[model samples]
Target: MIQLITLDMAGTTVTDHHEVEACFAMAAQKSGLTVSDDRILAMQGLHKYFVFQTLWEEILGTTTHPEWQMRVDNSYRVFTEVLENHYLTHDITPTEGCLELFEYLHIHQIKIALTTGFYRKVCNIILEKLGWLEGLDDTHVGTASTTIQASITSDEVEKGRPHPFMIQKAMNLLHISDPQQVINVGDTPSDIQSGFAANCRLSVALSNGTHAADLLTPHNPSLLLGSLHELIPVLEDLRTRS
Candidate 1:
């Protein structure tokens, strides 16, 4: 039986209407980086700082270049400013069926943990806006009455998506040892890759988020969902089989 469910923020749980990509583009423009939208989208679910570092390295052909660190820092700073401001000033809402899914998990005695590419500050901002941080402490770990059992950010770990650090951190925080007892769900290829890297029982993808089904398919998610509500039957089926 699945004991924990790890969900990605932004496109997976929170409503994302390309605002992240827009922020990345704005930052790139300000930092004089010539990046395309597809490139930015491709980096979704990665640590924002790592994204900038990789982008700068790709453009300069080498990280040893003198201007690499400066470019990466400047672009990352701008991106963080833009992203944090966007979340602070704009309306933030849960994706469709998100609350319902949460309720289902709660009723079923399953633990819910959120994993995000966002840093802690921005992640807390979004969670606060949705009232999802009510009972969580400064570390963002919640109790039985709280909406979620844990919240893990990319900054909290040594590496982000496509690596399993964040997920492993969540498992550690929740005292879950076997990855086979966890189900990971997200809307990006990096998210799928990370879940599989963690050796999760299921690495599921949602097509209605940052990337389309065609784009996420190559990552080989165990299951692809069109909406959050679809997860209910899948979980039920898994429980039965297990």
Candidate 2:
């Protein structure tokens, strides 16, 4: 009885390949802050600006610092440029069997929405590159799998993952109520937390994306999957259970 499935953009539906963390790391360094890859990866599924804000605060050891906003802004601006250029110049691919999963959901009359921690501009760039924007309507773009019902981004919401704003926004736009009829799938702890906050019937994680199974495990999703391909059977099973 699932009405909608909200999937994350990077690291969940799209391939990460460590590019995101690389960009963040470079941006941090450019802003005069040194950060580890693990720390950057741990911040996945959060709003980009908030990520810099938190990192800057921690690096400087004080939120009360007068230059906090300036530093955060500088780091975030650099990160956005780096990330967008990386996606635009580099090859980006969707996760294995991602398109097939979209087709299955489409055939079942289950709407799919992409909810991302990324801002709208870069999201469009990635979608366009993958041809996911083909035949796009006002709400969403179409891919080989199916036409998405909506594409919600972090900037579109008051807050990002772990706050459930993006998922909630997608549900509202797609006219989906009853969180029990929703499935939120992601590759990070924040993604799992966000789904649960929305009370989704299925809050699942994919280890093949961003965080490893070990990192996502403690978040306690309904299940942990390896890739989007694995979710097809689970969805079919859920249909049967319904």
Candidate 3:
């Protein structure tokens, strides 16, 4: 049975509109590095620091730039400021059909978990702005609908996407022990890899958020949908079978 659904923030459940990439590129530019839009988009769903490290590595052509750590730290510090202000200043909203999906899962007694590449501060800003910050636990925030069982952020986990730590942590917080009972959906390759690594029953991908359908296809997701509105049928079918 699918007891829980773990969804990603930003480009997954939330409408991103490339604001994240813009912020990252802005920070990179400020830090004396030229980061391409494709490169920034490719790093979506990774921990912000790692994103900075990787970009810096590419710019310097080695992981061992003499001041690599310093540069990474400086760039990340700037990125965080830019990202936080961007979110706080902008009017953030859930992606199309995101709330409907949450409601459907709620009615079916399926738990909703929100996991994000963002650290707690930025993630909370987005959540609070969307009015989804009610019923928060010490470690995480809950949705306004009370359907969200857990919220996991990169800051709360030892690692981010492409690793199963955040998903596993959400499962743990939600009191869900079986990875087979979980479905993970996101809009990035890292999202797919993380779900697969978590051993989830369904590693679903959404194409409407960040990457294109073609960009996400090679990850071999168990299911891929262009929009969140199409999620119900896929989930209902799984419910019937399981």
Candidate 4:
């Protein structure tokens, strides 16, 4: 039986379009980098540091240096300060049907794991802002919140997506020995790749994230659902078939 479900954050769990773009723009300017909305939107689903390095290099005509990394770090700290203290409070919110889905999964005795490319600090800030930290410790939630050195490290080969280490770590943390008994629900192609890397029994992509249905169709997900509202019904149908 599928006993665990690993979820992705960002566009998958919380909805915040303007806040993300505004922060990126302001951070880029403070770091002496210039960025456009199109570029920022195009790089959605990528890790924050990678996005910073990529955009900084693209804008400043050079790759990142240690000093540049420091600047980026400072800019990001300020950005996150604003995000957590203000923007997040005003902008970020959970998707439709998220609460109902969480309750259903809990009642079913299925473990819920949350994995993200983001470091624990940033993840904590967002989760705290959204009141997700409490849920992270619930019996049903398995979170990748440990120190990178202490925790099973996720690989970021050739970019974070289309690689599997993040999801694999989630499984390990959740004590899910059989990937075939776990399901992954995410909003990006990287999520699918992680599920495949972990050899998950099932992977479902949702249109509620960065990409639209027509765009993500090319990635060939096991199934595509419009929103979290469809999760229970889809799983019910899968159960019937089995």
List TM-score per model, in order.
0.98, 0.95, 0.95, 0.77
State the TM-score for model 3.
Answer: 0.95
RMSD of each: 0.8, 1.9, 1.6, 4.9
Instruction: Give the per-residue lDDT of model 3 (tens digit) for 1-242.
Output: 99989999988889989999899889988998787788788889999898888878887889877988899999999999999999988888889889889889988889888899999899889878886777877767454357477889987778898999999998888788999999999999999999999999999999998999999999899899987879998888888887
- Tell me the tens digit of each residue's lDDT in model 2 across 40-157: 8899989989888898889778878999889998889998889899988999898887989988988998988899988989999998898777676676644335467778888888
List the pairs of residues colliding in candidate 4: none
Error of model 1, residue 56, in angstroms: 0.7
- Candidate models: Cα lDDT each: 0.93, 0.88, 0.88, 0.65
| Model 1 lDDT per residue over 68-140, tens place | 9999999999999999999989999999889999999998888899999999999999998999999998778
The ten-residue window of minimal lDDT in model 2 covers 138-147
In model 2, what lDDT does residue 191 have?
Answer: 94
Candidate 4 overall Cα lDDT vs. reference? 0.65
Model 4 stretches with alpha carbons more than 4 Å out: 59-75, 135-162
Question: Can you tell me which runs of candidate 1 are displaced by over 4 Å?
Answer: none
User: What TM-score, to 2 decimals, does candidate 2 have?
Assistant: 0.95
Judge candidate 2 against the unseen true structure and give its global Cα lDDT, from 0 to 1. 0.88
Q: Which pairs of residues collide in candidate 3?
A: none
lDDT of 4 by residue, 1-242 (tens): 76777777766666645456677677767766667877766666567677776666665557645466666677667665654555435646777666677777676666666666555656666666666665344332433432111122122233465566666665666677888878887777777767777788877888877767876678788889888888888766766676
Best of the candidates, TM-score = 1
